[model samples]
Target: MFKYIKNDLPASIVVFFVALPLCLGIALASGAPLFSGLIAGIVGGIMVGALSGSQIGVSGPAAGLAAIVLAAIATLGYENFLVAVVLGGAIQLLFGILRLGIIGYYFPSSVIKGMLTGIGIIIILKQIPHFFGYDPDPEGDFAFFQVDGKNTFSEILETVNNISPGATLIALIGLGILLLWSNVLSKKGKFFQLVQGPLVAVVIGILFYVFTKNNETLAISADHLVNVPVPEDASSFLAQFSFPNFAAITNPAVWLTAFTIALVASLETLLCVEATDKLDPEKRVTPTNRELLAQGTGNIVSGLIGGIPITQVIVRSSANIQSGGKTKASAIIHGFFLLISVMLIPRLLNMIPLSVLAAILFIVGYKLAKPKLFKTMYQLGWKQFLPFITTVLVIVFKDLLWGIGIGLAVGIAVILIKSYQNSHFLHIEGEDVDDGKIKMTLAEEVTFFNKGAILKELDKLPENSYLELDVTKTRYLDNDIIEILEDFSTKAKNKNINIKLISERGIVENPPSYIEFFKLRPKTSV
Candidate 1:
């Protein structure tokens, strides 16, 4: 795990920067104490990272759960909500034990690709306002309709009027430095590679803020900077940690909330696991069950210590991957950084400008949704492209799960349509003769979905024809299809169509009872 310390250390710093604002912002959005988000970040990074099978995934308080958390807190109270979180974690552990991680494997590849690309576009769109210093919404809010009552586009239009010259200038400089460090400087020297461009951009941003404090036009306001709560002393810091009200576990609402969190968090974690694996340069597959167990443990620990719900976050994970993280050490170390910085150098951290961070995210977003990928998906044809584009558009317009849900629905519809069209192949051996010979070969897997196609083809068989039904390649023939064939055989006799059935068992001249014949044979191919 420590073999890539050199790579992991730099990547951890970048992830820490990315995770910090998100942690605080998500907690604020959820209507929970700000410290709880940091607690989630710390626990997710260290505990989950240590236990997770994923080499690159970073877990933390997710923005996706903010709305849910907010309502739960209002209904059950904060202490009571912690009880739900603990139960949710226990439920996740149960899911892992049952090996339900296979659920993630069911999502189509097109939808997964669409998810990554859609999130990338969202990051770029959402960060533009922050880049210009008009941050009405929190950092991690990725929904189309924001918590601030403004949608994504309206917020950008609003930012145009409220632009801060100081923020814009620093953002430009930060973006430039990042581009230079990544494109030119990093390749020139090992030292540049070790130091990381985002860290340099952040440091410069801080110095600029400090140097321009007295300047009216150039100085960045505190609102445009990172805000970490400062503790007056150790006692005050310890007081921030709240314990769960276990007595509330008996509340029916608590149980429902727990189940909701467990389902949503597990789904989000699994999706992130799939996306993160795709983003990994090494392409290592993470064990989904292990990931669930790790996440469950993290959430339970976080709840006990007053933290928001935890899930594997794609943004931070992508940041880690883009920053050259090679192992889970990067994630674990980032957690330590969060713990140390919040306890020690929070004042210094608060000096870093949000615009500079936004600049870093701009690059991360670009890498995930490159223009070439759009064309590539298109070239793959409509079967793959429809779901891919649908996922992207819906995600940009709605939310992550909504996008996936709609995309999956569309993908399934496409599959059914294709299946209905290609259920069987018909060949006219001698159509011009008075006694025509026709051959109809069934697909490898014939289900009820193919019934329409088969019925239509059977109805078109000419009178006084010889029909050869081939099932040599078929496996798992649906009972509904067999009933259709039985009815067709009766019709064929009236039309004077002689029917010959061919199968793996043996050829038969119109098998007396289609259902009875299939019952004696294996449903699948031998």
Candidate 2:
């Protein structure tokens, strides 16, 4: 673990920049104080990173939880919502204890890709208003509409009319810094590489805002400022801590929210674990069950301390990898950085412009949806590609979870269709049959699904003198199918035909065991 620190420390800086806006954005989306999200990020980084079995998974406040948080707060009070969060954490811990970590494996690859792509599009879309310097009721960027009730596209139209010239100019400058930071200076030298592009862009954005203020020619204004809440003193800062409402523990809504957050957050975490492992330079696989336990434990602690729900965030994890993180140390250190940075440099943080962070996020967004990424997924197979592209597009146009759900449904449908096709009625082999008495064979594991086809073939076996019913190699035979054979056998007897029974169990004596007959027979090659 310590070894991971040395290698990942550099990468943590990049992750820190990426995690910043996300923390704020998710908090804003959750209808909580902006600092609450930051608190979650800090604690998630420290606690989850330390306890997690995963080497590459990076924990932080998640966008996926934002909707839950928003609805919870609206339905329950903010204090009640905090109770839900804490309760959610406790529930997740219980899940870990039950060893339900493998649940993450059930999510198909297509669905997971759809989820990530969908999230990427959301990040880009949500950031658009901020990039234009229009707050329009600061819910960050998680909705189809502005908090003012204007839809996303309508908000954009409103942004054109209400765009603060100063914010736009600052944003453009931030964009320039981001472009230069990610593309140009990044390749210059060892010295330049150590200094992240987002950091420079942020600094330039802040200073530019400060310089252009009230200058008609430069066009900077008050609305273009970072709205970081300023605490008057230590007492006010410390007063932000929220306690869990034990009374709400029994409420079904609270329990429901807890399970919802745990399930969604855990799924997101596992996907991040896999994706992060893929991005690993050493290419090590993180212990997934162990990761679930870690996240569960982290959420419990975060909830207890008044932070938002947490997950293994991919944006930060990927940034950590791209920034050259080689171990968990980078992830752990970033958490410590968050803890120390907020407490010690609150005012200094206020100096950073949102536009600069936007620039940084723009970079992160580009990395996720890069055209090369599209081409690469496309090459994998249509099974992977169609859902992935569709997911990204829907997620861009609609909601994140909805896009993922759609992708997952489509992926499952594709698999089931293939399974049905592969499971044909009869896989016939041997000489081509021009005669009425044709031979047919069931697959090794035949289910009742194949009964219709088998019945049709049996009906066509004209009152024959010689008909061979071979089940010597068949592993599974459903009772419905057995009944079909029995009916045919009785009919053959009426026709004075001899039906050969070549099976492990005699056609007349096979019992109605659900699935045991299939496994009892040792595979025989004919």
Q: Which candidate tops lDDT?
A: 1
What are the Cα lDDT values of the candidates? Answer: 0.88, 0.68
lDDT of 2 at 199: 64
Once superposed on the true structure, which residue ranges of model 1 sit more than 4 Å away at CA? 422-526
Candidate 2's C-alpha runs over 4 A off are 2-7, 137-140, 145-147, 217-219, 379-381, 424-526
Q: TM-score for all predictions?
A: 0.81, 0.75
Candidate 1 residue lDDT tens string, 187-215: 99899999999999999999999999899
Candidate 1 achieves a global lDDT of 0.88
Estimate the overall C-alpha local distance difference test score of candidate 2. 0.68
lDDT of 2 at 383: 60
Q: What tens digits encode model 2's per-residue C-alpha lDDT throughout 194-265?
A: 766666676777677667665886654444455555677789878887767878878898888888888888
TM-score for model 1?
Answer: 0.81
Q: Which candidate's TM-score is highest? A: 1
